[model samples]
Target: MTKAYFILILTSFVVAGCGTTQVKRGNLGKVIEPQESRLILSTKNIVSVGDVMLRAGEYSKEGIKLETETFNLKDSQTTSVKHKQHTFIFSIPSGEYLLYSQNNEGSYYASEQPFSGLKGTKDGYGGLFVPNGSPSATEFYWNWNKAPNVLFAHQAMLLTPINGSIGKTSSALKNKNASIPSATLTYAGVASAQVRFVYKEFTADGYARPAFTQEVSLDYKPGGTYAYKSALFKVYKADSTSINFEIINPLY
Candidate 1:
């Protein structure tokens, strides 16, 4: 069958399923369809996290015109409240898409690892970790143990120190008490010494953040001049098994 004819038939299936089908967008800014196929382009930039843009090929009598479409990851204004920006609302149809350029800003905290949303050749639904803020903000206690020679240096946010317990924490510990060194006590006792570690409270802005971006190309047939710009995406295929993309871009 011809490309245009196939697209026509595919549109029917999409329209028929619209009533019952629900579209879900992920933090990486891509539409997630478990039993369907599509493509999305998004950035990790905090200012533009909710906005997604893609470079598409539009066939014209002169040549294939390059077009851009920007949309919010959210589907509705209500959902956009938390997301914050929604210039366009649109979806992507199933077809081969290509990633030509990718820039991954490293994670803010050394403990938190940064990731490029979609990687290599992948099929089916996927999620990308968008750094909204520090991985965590709440203060918690850890390294609960007893010390022999009680050398309690600091106090914990929760749970009072019983004897020689320390409440050293992971991230909060560093943020609050950078001057305090790990307690090195002289433990002479044998079978009854536990240590406790504490993590103090902190805010999300305590650490730095990362912003990533990637440029992708959608497959389109090379005909007519376009009148206006739109989020128009033709349904090229309907089979959920037909969608897949190869990552040819770097994440740096």
Candidate 2:
């Protein structure tokens, strides 16, 4: 049998200081020969743009053994490319594997959960007010009523057996309680496919927020075939005044 591999492309606009500033950011990483008895992994142009770092690991029932490789872009002088791509190569024994990429500062990885619930209150003078029970007027002034904001956004991919035996699902999978638009799935090859998820976010006052609807497309492929699946898409939010609770495991 031929060797199998997995590739991931993560793209986003870098936002800083309360989502005020936006900059283009991208990173690419891959794992080859995942299921082969022996494999080779390689990378290129990864450290050319923005600081780049790569990591590889083998997954098994026992545990995970990880190895890391780091490349510093800050120390090196390189021009920014409009469409720069990075590549990584590795050799390993046959089995399932995971790969990750990050910036030189050490801040990027696929995570299951990204954000946490609001834990503190706001006080007068826009300072941190430590009170309870949803910011009453006595505890906070109207100007001090600080709404939540998006701090960070993260994305990750999870692979599972296609025979429905793994019992794994997408992070943005659908549920009966939620309203979702119809989705289409495209089969790319034997082990890979794409699925798209589209939905809208409504406010507490019973109005649909403008530009609140989002579609997220994800690509899936097995170790065998090269078929392309339709893109799977989902929407996530940093904060919403109308929504009381954070949407948990949006897609189950």
TM-score: which candidate is best? 2
Report the C-alpha displacement of residue 166, candidate 2, in angstroms.
38
User: Please, what are the lDDT tens digits per residue for candidate 1 over residues 1-252?
Assistant: 999999999998877655431222311223222122122322211111122111212111112122221111221111001112211111111221211111142111111111111323112221112223323211111111322222211111212111111112211111233323121111111112221111122223433122212222233221111111222222222121221112121111
Write one digit per residue (lDDT tens) for candidate 2, span 149-222: 21222121112111111111112212333333222221111112343333344454445555755543345322
lDDT for residue 17 in candidate 1, whole number 0-100? 56
What are the per-model numbers of colliding residue pairs? 17, 39
Query: Which numbered prediction scores highest in lDDT against the true structure?
Result: 2
Q: Model 2 off-target regions past 4 Å?
A: 1-192, 222-252
Name the weakest run of 10 consecutive residues (lDDT summed) in model 1: 75-84
